[model samples]
Target: MNWHGLKAIYLHEMDRMRRTLFQSLVSPFISTSLYFVVFGSAIGSRITEIEGISYGSFIVPGMIMLTVLTQSISNASFGIFFPKFTNTVYELLAAPLSTFEIILGFVGAAATKSLIIGTVIILTAGIFVDLHIEHPFIMMFFLVLTCVTFSLFGFLIGIWADNFEKLQVIPILVITPLVFLGGSFYSINMLPEFWQKISLLNPVLYLVSGFRWSFYEIADVSILTSLITILFFLSACVLTIIYAFSKGYKIKN
Candidate 1:
């Protein structure tokens, strides 16, 4: 691995984000706040607490997860997509860095942005509603894990997409619907037997449930199971990317 090349790419991506810090940072924080207001206050008031936690508090992790997932995907996807679109990727391909190094540089930067945005969103949630952490370590662990996994998934999307419109199709059309239906606002227990079975198939549910467990010391699914699911997804994404790079799919062509 060429450490210098990795550093160069990492620094370049970080600087690009810094240049648009306002849109990249402030906008996500504001948008998360609106979710708390509209869903946390308005809709939350109508729904009773789940598993003894208040409705507003119950959705905090899901809200935070939502922002982390979307931002990470957008950041990583754009990081690679723009370079490919403008033909700058040829330079990267010719660089001394290995494929792993290239993935780390861009994905790491994307995860960092999501991590910062997620932390800010958590703090912002506190202003509107009192927050508590039943397991601080677990909360931080899952936060970082969620960021890394989604960033890699974003990297995959960037490689697969050939245009700007195609780039957004995954996050907007696929991820968004999966998130909303993934028991973000309500517990799976609240659903009928048929729907509850179906909800289990949505991977986002495990993430939200795991994150919520960190906050309330409780979850709809077991924390161990959630952890395993996250690991499985992360491993799968890494393998897919490795195969893509080895085959020169999208990147070489």
Candidate 2:
């Protein structure tokens, strides 16, 4: 593998992040903090506890996941899409870097950003409520898994998009809604039995449920199911990426 080339690409992406510190970092940080302020105060006043966990504390994982998911997609999609927009991707395609190196560089940087933001979200949550982790390692696992998987998904979207408008479409129109409806603020069980059954079909529920389980040992679905759901999405993203690169879907042309 071309380690130098990979590092160059990775550092370049990270440098871009450093340059756009507020948009890349501060924007989400403030947005999440506001969610805590609004949801933690307004809603928490009404629903003091959800399944024996403080309403504020219970929503922490979901809120973090919400930001992580959108940020992962936003960072990665823009990372690749800018190159395509500037006609620089042709230069990259002609370079000595392998497809794996290219993916690792972009996806790795995106995941790293998500990790930083996720950690920040956790720290921010502490100010609003007393927080404890029932399973720290499991939380990290779910966190890392979600970051990597979604980054890859975003990388895929970047490749598929031909315009800036297209880039924002899926994240705003599709992903954000899924995260909101995925039992992020409340338990699926709180839904009526009929609606609860329907909620089970939303894939993101497994992610929120699994991450929440690591925090409070309270989950709407089994941990095993959550693990499987994330792994499945990870595999799907990996395979789709492979296909895109092999076919030179948007990179070459």
Candidate 3:
């Protein structure tokens, strides 16, 4: 492995976003604060606590996970898609870097962005509400793992998207809706029996539940189960990306 090449690519992507650091770092916090104001304060006041945690604190994990997931996906997707769109992917293809190196570079950058944004959201949430962290170590573990997993998923999306518009289809059409309906603002128990069962089918629920477990010491779903699901999804995504790279899907053409 060309460690230098991987580091260089990672740094290059980091620098690109760093140049727009104000927007990259601040925009998410601003948007999340708005959610707190609108959803947490306004609507949350009407709704009682979920699992003994105030509605505001209850949604913090989901908000943080939402930012992490979306940022990781966007960063990874754009990192690959922009190169392909501008024909700069040819440069990488000609370079001595292996596919693993490329994935490491892009995915690492994406994960870094997700981590920063997630941290920002957490800190901002602290400003608005008092939150208790039950297991800090577990929270950090899941945060990093989730970022890396979704970043890889985004990298796959980048490879599959032939056009700029197509690149956003999944995040816009699929992910956004799943996040909201995934019980981010409310608990699954609040739903009727049928809808509660249906909500279980949404993978984001596990992510939110696991994250919430770290903070509140309570989870809508089992933390062990969520971790297992995350591992399975992460492994599957990594294998798929590797297969795509080997086949030269979209990247070669």
Candidate 4:
């Protein structure tokens, strides 16, 4: 299917990432590094370990997932949003690329960028703490799955947004807060029993739990549940995108 058109769009998005190296790459890296420094120093001093893993090491998976999720959304959203903002989306729409091919290019490029940033952060984390992967293949699986799922979600955001403010709204107001409360820096087990049950309502918990499980073989929830949760969201995003494309939501208007 329209492989050439797909490659063109993919390369265009990837090239923009190269051009915006600082904002796209360095900014997130520095911000996540700060989380490690602050949390590892101030909080690590008080709490030595969670579930037999060192405080500094324990947060690595969560921190990486946090960065991946935000970066995926931001990268994919901006990748497509800029085309719409510049009135270039119509040109792409008029091209030979089908909806699936267009999505493949944009979302694939965005996921690639997020995966790169996540890998960098993981390497950066290793310098500060001793790290281990109980299951390296599983770790990679969860990493790729998270990037792809959230990239699709971000693509939806791109199509739905009408302005710059709308682009920032969900990530700022909703996602970041969910991550903080979703067992990123601390285990949900530390919470009161009632609150622990309450924490389950936050979807990000499953993400962090599953990713963390790949690392230490310990988790707040079962790996199966986490896998299912991400898969469910991924499928939902896929269906929503197809419907939006068919109905020409935001894109055609």
Candidate 5:
């Protein structure tokens, strides 16, 4: 299993995070806090509550998911991308580490960072609005699954990227928009009936839906659907990673 190699790589990534603590951690925290301030003050005025949950409280789950999703990808993608950028990946490939160990170390650390940020965001949200978890276990399960799954997805991004700019492409152009449009800030029910159906197609909706469900027991879709969606995404990311490694995509070269 190469436990020593795995531990070394894991510590290296964690150390890197510590070194860039502000950019890696505090930046997202500050940004999300602003969402509460601006959105809560502005939007909260127009929309007092959604499904009886206060506007600020209603957006808490979505806010956390938004941060966790983007941060997971950024953290994991940059963690591996930097090594590739510096031509240090070849050294990692030569080390006494199996592919599984390498992935576990990098992805695990990314997930851990996202999870910590998620918890902190939750606590920070509590100060703004009343926060309660009707289903703490389910809330945690979704949180962990989201972090790990997206971390794996980010790992693929890290491997696929050959340059620095490519790293921002998906998170900015794709992921961020998906979150904002995917019932993160507002319930899908508020949309017209036709648009509500369309919202179902956005993958992040299921995640935000189920996550919000854990807090208030209300969701745009069934909790089962959300669980299946994340699991399916997780499986797909795993398969894609295996294929990428087999073909040596952006790695062996």
Candidate 6:
């Protein structure tokens, strides 16, 4: 399994986080605080509750998911992309590590970082709102699954990217918008009946729906559908990563 090689790569990525502690950790924390301040103050005044949950509390899961999703991709993508950018990936490829070990190290560390950030944001959110977890186990399961799934997706982005700008493309142009529109800040029920059905087409809706369900026992979609959606994407990302490694796609370039 090349445990030593895996540990080395894992530690290297973790060390990078330590070096950029402010950007990697604190920045997200501050941004989340601002979201609470702006949204809780400006929006909370107008809408007190959604489905019996306070406006502030209602958005916690969505807020956490938003940060975790973007950060997971950014961290994992940059972790591998930097090595490729600097031509250090060939050295790692030539090392004793197997493909699985390499992926485990990078994706595992990225997931860990995102999880930590997500947890911290949760704790931070508690200070502003009264929080409850009807399904703590389910909440954690969704959290872990989201982190790991997106981390793998980020790994693919790392391999596919040829320049630094490409790294920001998906997260900015695609993911962020999906999250904002995906029942994150507000429930899809608030939308018109037709738009509610249209919201279902956005993949992030299922994710936020399921995650929010874990917290409040409420969701825009069925929990089963959300779980299935996550698992399907996770499997797809894993298979894509395998194919990329086998083909030596961007790695050998």
lDDT of 2 by residue, 1-253 (tens): 9999899999999998799877766776688789888998898999999999989999999999999999899889999999999989887788998889999999999999999989988987887789999999999999999999999999999999999999999999999999999999999989999989988989999999999999999999999999999999999999999989999887764
RMSD of every prediction:
1.0, 1.0, 0.8, 1.0, 1.1, 1.0
Global lDDT of each candidate: 0.91, 0.92, 0.92, 0.93, 0.92, 0.92
* Residue-level lDDT tens digits of model 6 in 1-253: 8998999999999998899888876787798899999998789999999999999999999999999999999999998999998988888899988788999999999999999999989988988888899899999999999999999999999999989899989889998999999999999999999999989999899999999999999999999999999999999999999989988888864
Residue-level error in angstroms, candidate 1, position 33: 1.7
lDDT accuracy of residue 55 in candidate 2: 90
Q: On residues 1-253, what C-alpha lDDT tens digit does candidate 1 reach at each position? A: 6899889988998898899989977887788788888988898888868899888888889888888999899899999999999989999999888999999999999999899999998888888878999999999999999999999999999999999998999999999998888877889999999999998999999999999999998787999989999999999999999999999999896
Please report, as a residue range, the 10-residue window in candidate 2 with the lowest summed lDDT. Answer: 23-32
Model 1: lDDT equals 0.91
Estimate the lDDT of model 4.
0.93
**lDDT-superior candidate, 1 or 2:** 2
- Candidate 5 structure quality by residue, lDDT tens digits, 93-178: 88988777888999999999999899889888887887999999999999999999999999999998988899999999999999
Candidate 3: list runs displaced more than 4 Å. none
**Which number leads on TM-score?**
3
Query: Candidate 1 deviates by what RMSD?
Result: 1.0
Colliding pairs, model 6: none
Q: How well does each candidate superpose onto the true structure, as a TM-score?
A: 0.98, 0.98, 0.98, 0.98, 0.97, 0.98
lDDT of 4 by residue, 193-223 (tens): 9999999999999999999999999999999
Backbone clashes in model 4, listed as residue pairs:
none
Question: With candidate 4 superimposed using the best TM-score fit, by how many Å does residue 61's alpha carbon deviate from the native?
Answer: 0.6
Which 10 consecutive positions of candidate 6 have the poorest summed lDDT?
A: 20-29
Off by over 4 Å in 2: none
Cα deviation at 143, candidate 5, in Å, is 0.6
| Per-residue error (Å), model 1, residue 99 | 0.8
